[model samples]
Target: MYHRDRSPCSALAVSRSVERPRAAVLLLHGGHEYGTSAPGAWNLPAARMVPFERAVRRATKEHDVLIGRVRYRCRGWNGGRADAAHDAERALHELARVAGDVPTVLVGHSMGARAALRAAGGAHVRGVVGLAPWCPPEDSVRHLDGRHVVLLHGDRDRVTDPKASADFLARARAAGADASFVEMRGSGHAMLRRSAAWHELTTSAVTGLLGLTPLSSPFTGEGRLLSGA
Candidate 1:
């Protein structure tokens, strides 16, 4: 058996499996990203998701974790009614049920970051990694209690405001969540310029959030710890 039921949300790509995963990580890609699907449609392993998917592969090899990469149903998440968020939510639910209640982490980029944070409050979600994340004013403090969140943004990012991520981290901590912010200097929203550094930061943060490793850098970088617990 492929061991999966095909649904719209079930299209997420599953990684190399461990018999009983210690945790599960879902990779959510950004909005306005092109995929093989039609406009206003969702597809897996989108162009923007490649880097994060590589990160997931690296992290899983080092740790006992399962991977889920979600494709959203739309190109935009405007006005707070987003099919992307719903798709992520459904993927998480489906992953949780199949994986047997393991710790769930959502690692997202850009608009996907917004969706991850929105879905973090849902059942089985353990933490969130927001890379160049788009943080809405309303979603900053929702259902964050007892969840861990990390925001990593590039200072040179013009697509998503790094300041907004910093501000949201502060608000999330104040509203009873363990949250932190990291600013990657000399980096861009695409994260391709410092691709190595971006991937390292995301993997290190996710492993640390899982309590499987300390928050130690694998490579030297110009990243600065803005604030955290």
Candidate 2:
């Protein structure tokens, strides 16, 4: 069943399959580069991630995996303040309170991906799935040691630099993290061009990171290329 959990700066749409979850996945939605306004329920970026929430729920229906979609407090990254990442960290803390230290994975898109990557240093975070992430040059990979990181970026994206994500992956691997990158050809920043492909890859990545299943072909190898169309 699904329920809502509220915090000072964020909320969670949680789907719990068991009383105490064996694992958990938190979904973060896309947003702008700079905006301080609060995001309402009907916001387009939040709405865009609804399908992913459903896909993950279905993929882990038989397992005791707790799924949560985080509603950020603001609509943008807001420079170095990283408000969204703080909210994600809060959500993770809340999840820990409800689920008790079960392994957790974060799945984020666009700006949300940046937040997830920044928050992946949390003790409970076991892995991260970044979709068309916005990885700036200043982003660091040192904290990702021993964690699993998978980045999926569309080569055609104009909103975020795919090359930056590639560079981040290179640094992540060199830093001792089990990281991989998937170049999604023909897809763009919005991930609407090949929606199904994005969904499939996301599901596979989540399940694989949680050890419920093996990763799909694209993520089985380092820096694999996949057709997003």
Q: Name the top lDDT candidate.
A: 2
lDDT digits (tens) for residues 1-229 of candidate 2: 4345655544565755467689999999999988899886588887778888889989999899988877688898999889888888888888887788899999999999999999899998999999999999898889999888999989899989999998888888888778888888888888888889889889999999898998666666654434443
lDDT of 2 at 92: 88
Looking at model 2, the pairs that clash are none
Q: What is each predicted model's overall lDDT from 0 to 1?
A: 0.75, 0.85
Looking at model 1, residue 34 earns an lDDT score of: 36
Clashes of each: 0, 0
lDDT by residue for model 1 (87-180), tens: 7887887787767788888999998898899889977887899989988666758588878888888888998899889788778877777787
TM match of model 2 to true structure: 0.92
